[model samples]
Target: MSHHFDYPSDETLDISDAYCFAGAGDAHGPRTVFGMNTSPFGAPTWNATGYYELKIDTDGDYIEDITYRATFPIGSDGTQHVQVEQLTGAAARDRTATGMIITPPNAPIGQVVECQGGITLFAGERLDPFYNFIPYPVATTTALKDGTFPDFPAAGPASDSFANTGVRSLVLEVPVKITGREPVHFWATTAYFDKGHNTWIQVQRAGKPNMTTFFDFANGTAKIADYNGTAPTIDLVGRPAHPATDPATGIWGQVRDNIAAVVEAGGTYDQLPHAFPTPRAYGAWAADRLLPNVVKFIPGTVALWDPWCDIQNGKGIIEDIASNIIKMIVNQDFSSGLTPGPVLDYFPYLSTPPPPAS
Candidate 1:
């Protein structure tokens, strides 16, 4: 799962996005759920003031064809009100496009609005569903520095770093008919209306869990912000050349080098014998799989993110995403060894927010 605080503190927008698409058996009749959670969850007021959007690319062009956006406005009673909109075609691609409102603007947090076209929307504080071993980042950094992979048991009984914490969440579930049966790619963004610039400034963009946090650990604030500001298409090609002396300006190069450093240090060449000859060769191959970091889901099928699963369609809220990602990067059966807590089985499926600390 994305830590949501991956960027520099000044540009911090703590929207960690996760998504899943369930089969026809669901009461919603095959729906795709997009979940966004923000940090420092239970406050006197909602922390996420800006709007969040789920971008869906239906035609496989890596460009969004449909967008479901949620905006929050604080009411006089100090509760946050949610308004959801559906944008399509040019509007979906354009940040300034408002499209059409699908849900009633007066709907407050915890209230489920059944919009036209069978869309269900909810916005409120919820227990963050992301679970990871507390020291995973430290372990990864250690691997980069000393070539030692994390030993789950040695980390002192897997502990969930996000347990009991909460997040301001915007969850939207749309019927499969809206996205059709074709495979679609999904990513999310957090943006604020910049009064000075007279345009929306996207502060964060997330798709695959932990892509920015894990692979781009070596990059500085500017590079991290640039990664969040851009689209998946740019990710696939690569970022522009850096002004610095380092020629590894492209995202692929950076990702490859980072992974290669760990593989070379750990002496894990035997793990991927087919990538052959050198750790860099394996790194390059792995980079291809990790780039263009969007979640792909074929509607009407259950979504899962297991590395060994033949089809990793999409990421479920409770999926062990951290473990799967670690296993992929190292080409080993690594695990976070921390299990996610239980969540509700119905609409707005996340568990209720934990009570505020005394």
Candidate 2:
């Protein structure tokens, strides 16, 4: 399963956060599950009252065909309530459309609220499921500058940096009938109602795990808003054409060069297809695979992230995605060497949150 964990403290306004896509079959039939985690400890709670949305594209076009959105409002007792809606066609693309409400208004957290048409909703705080070496971002940034991949194991012992942290989570399960039986593209976003503008303003969008973290490190947080506000279709084909020598022309070029630089520094540039003998060529190819970032899920199939080719086919919550991404970039069979935490086997598969901190 692909997930995003935004780390920039100053850019908290653009933190749209984690995503997981999985499909399973049961006696009732096949179902698709979408998971999100946001508001890391001490961060702004923009997503709490804002919107957490899942957009699905049934055909290959990268445009959304369906949207499942959830909103949380805090009760007087300081507890959060979740309300979900389903939108399709034009409404799916229109952020202002109310569409159709699927779950009852203000459903309590930590309890599964069943809605019509076999949809299940759960929203509450949960232990963060993403794992990685604590200093991964720093190490990657240094690697880009010094022309060498950092020895991750040398920085520290294997451990989950996200341990002991919690995030507000929204989990939604819908039957395949609503999402369609064919393979679909998936991406998630977070938006806040901008009363100043009289409309909801999208602050963040994500698909693949760590795309912004790993690839955008060199540019700092300068592009966070542009990256978050735009759609995948823009990343796929909307970039301005530029000469090969200038790799900083568009977001696509920036991301492509970022991937290429990391791989080249890791000493794997030569291993890419010999047809593209230069780093820019290999980077261009690699960027193409990653752009228009969205998870592709075929209903009733195993949801596994292909570490070898970076081919995403949905993501399970327990997958060691950090290691998988490292392996994909370096073209080496390496891992973060960190052990992952456990998750539940039933609905709301994320691990339970630790008892309230003392």
Per-residue lDDT for 263-349 in model 1, tens only? 666667456433445766666666666767788988777778764333478888888887777765676667666778988888788
lDDT tens digits by residue: candidate 2, 125-244:
788877776566456656644556767766776667788777777788878777777888888887777788798777777787667656553244445566777788877542446424
Query: Which 10 consecutive residues of model 2 have the lowest summed lDDT?
Result: 7-16
Which predicted model would earn the best TM-score? Answer: 1
Residue pairs clashing in model 2 are 1-315, 1-316
**35: Cα error in model 2, Å:** 1.3
TM-scores for the candidates: 0.88, 0.86
Off by over 4 Å in 1: 7-12, 23-29, 40-44, 47-49, 76-78, 142-154, 217-222, 239-249, 272-275, 308-310
Question: What TM-score would you give candidate 2 relative to the actual structure?
Answer: 0.86
Q: For each candidate, what is the lDDT?
A: 0.70, 0.69
